[model samples]
Target: MHLHCYRWTGRGADRARESERRPPHPAFPASPLPPMRTCDWLLKPRTRIDASPATVAEAVAWLTRRYRSAAESFLHPDGEARIGLDLRLHLAEEHLAGGVDVQWGIWLRGGDFITAAVICCSPNRHAPHPCPAAS
Candidate 1:
């Protein structure tokens, strides 16, 4: 497994330059913009994996648990607060042939869930696509 952590500064030029430096994964095409709202601004820790769905689910579950616990530390009884989870799953043919790339993220504001989403993108070369309308 390989891990690549990114820190987002909310700069479009920075993102574009970064993208230019690294070619998209052969099995997971790149997008002009990510498919989820938070995904566009939140930092992502890249994980390279060749694993089954069960393994992926397990990893997500673990991260969810940890996020919940950490979120509490950021909470205050008399002020606004925010916490979230941002996950990106990139699967190659060698790992899961024909499997789509997945991106998921959620945000909690003032201890309430304000957003949650999951998006899938085709693992093929094509023009960039936009994210689906949020529900």
Candidate 2:
């Protein structure tokens, strides 16, 4: 149930400057502030589905239904299954105009669900590696 969170830098320098201008708290000395993020305060309740015995077809169906237009599935070199989704669409129909992109994904291995995540990144950046790296 661990969630990996990341900071999102907005469209341009303006957002960065806005964050820098905030006064430091009395207890801490003035320093550069972290960039603002779109999901800085996301508090939505989360539900975990145990897919231990679920067939590949069932898992695919569930992910497809949940993610709709955003879902993508792939097979790893080690035979694990992976599913991912671009979640920003939940907020707006169009891609942000030079804003961050938000995504979520899961990994299934040995009939058990392994890892899941929500990632936020700059629109111009790509994942550091391939979806399910080649051995």
Candidate 3:
């Protein structure tokens, strides 16, 4: 299952932009922004399919491409876009970490579309030795 998240910027929206340029002062109060609406989190292509390795690889590629495009977009003109930050694949899930399941995080943003912070949990853990039964 894909977990989707999103945010929108109407006219006079600059909170996302300001946050990046300057670190918030310790005494600065938080802005009370309104909650995102249901209609805002929609995507054009709504086809469902198996999320196999191939699909994931494609998604990764898409994220990578978007990153470059967005970075360029932000750099041009008056130096702005609704997209403040697109942190795709925030953390790498290394099997080196000791655990039964691998865990990771993602972050992204897209207008009128769901930017999912997708996490994958592996059923199998890394083992130095093969199962005794197999041996």
Question: Considering lDDT, where higher is better, how would the candidates rank from best to worst?
Answer: 1, 2, 3
- Weakest 10 consecutive residues of candidate 3 by summed lDDT: 41-50
lDDT of 2 by residue, 1-135 (tens): 112232222223333355443323331113222223323212111112122212323333333444442223322422322212333233322322233333333332232222222322221233332111111
Best by lDDT: 1
Clashing pairs in 1: none
Q: Kindly list the per-residue Cα lDDT of model 3 for residues 5-80, writing each as its tens digit.
A: 2222232343344433222332222322212221211211112111222334444444444444444433232332
For all predicted structures, in order, the TM-scores are 0.24, 0.19, 0.27
Question: What lDDT would each prediction earn against the true structure?
Answer: 0.29, 0.28, 0.27
Tens-digit lDDT track of model 1 for 98-119? 3333332233344332222122
**Per-model tally of clashing residue pairs:** 0, 0, 0
Error of 1 at 74 (Å): 9.1
